[model samples]
Target: MKSFEKELPENYDALKKKANYTSSWRDRLDAVTTLSAYQHEKVIDLLNNRMKNDTVFKVQTAAYKALVAFGENVEKPTPARFDVIKGPNKIFLRVKKSLPKDHTVEEFADKLKRMRLDVYDAFEGDKGDQFMTWLEERWAKL
Candidate 1:
């Protein structure tokens, strides 16, 4: 029986770009899943990079899973104590100050999206469907 090894796809460069797009954890996580289809060293290295250094825990976990699926020896990355959003309390305060006292959480979320897309994206990715709930909880505290 002849053994078959997966070859790098023509879209490898595009996938690489997605994997390295520092601003979007969703892109990086999707890239890890997409890269898992190939059995090439380049893909392995890219997954390794994400596993070791992605600021988002979800992206890092996706990369670790991909590498494990590829039969690579890797330790699971620790869950991040903090999210990619630095000083979220400060950001929340800024957003609060920008809004009227009677502003809704929806308004706050919209303002956050407009003001700090990085923070918005991180929370959205991290919280998934619970993003709104989390936002409301935080807003209540503010």
Candidate 2:
């Protein structure tokens, strides 16, 4: 039950989704390891689910280690689901799963800059909402 020392990324919710649902166990294991680093209260709950229900043995073991790191007992987990935003939340989430996992506002801006695409004053003479729509449409193709 070694503690994870790495830091969790801001895209953690997405990564958690990736861990439990991705076909690639390597990615799932990576996601679990990253999530363990955070020790978020919900993280233990998620790890318990992973330990109990994951089809992959290594992932279950990883989750067990993570629970141990958090000083939680594996056999006595509380009934909880880590659906942090089943509807939505105080902080917005990027639920656009069709796009690349690591795409960011900075990269989006840089790409727009390189392509000379203007999110501002570019579509139907509307700036903000139109930009989001444009980005969504383009991101869907990625």
Candidate 3:
């Protein structure tokens, strides 16, 4: 098996190709994580779907980790007033509600951590044999 770093795709198309050919749990996980780094909403959507249905334990774990990394990278710091430079392929979260924009970087980091915790709480589940069975059922539908 190729190392995850060695197998990482260079672009969206490459990622898709790799995903299609992925035969090992690690390969699938690497594919999702590599695609997530691109930060494109389309890639994120694809990874999310895979995460939901991937029968491989490592692949799902990698997908979740990649999602966390994607959120952290894309979410702008608070004092910036939600002003964001959306990359050509990436999505940005817009702030609809007004709030105090005078926050230090440390505060922003803390807030990001809290937000991450909330997300984790929503997605928490056992990653055991039962989960593997669930994944297999889900994957069959996909």
Predicted model with the maximum lDDT = 1
- Clash counts for all predictions: 0, 0, 0
User: Highest TM-score, which number?
Assistant: 1
Q: Which lDDT tens digits does candidate 2 get at residues 6-123? A: 4556897898797776345556678888888877766777788887766455677788888887877666333225321133221123333323678775565454434433221122
Better of 2 and 3 by lDDT: 2
User: In candidate 1, what are the lDDT values of residues 11-33, reduced to their tens digit?
Assistant: 99999999888668889888888
Candidate 2 Cα errors over 4 Å, as ranges: 1-9, 76-142
Ranking by lDDT: 1, 2, 3
User: What lDDT tens digits, residue by residue, belong to model 3 across residues 67-104?
Assistant: 66665333221211211112311110111012135544
Ranking by TM-score: 1, 2, 3
Evaluated against the true structure, the overall lDDT of model 1 is 0.85
For candidate 1, list the clashing residue pairs, or say none. none
Judging by TM-score, tell me the better candidate of 1 and 2. Answer: 1
> lDDT of candidate 2?
0.57
TM-score of each candidate?
A: 0.81, 0.46, 0.40
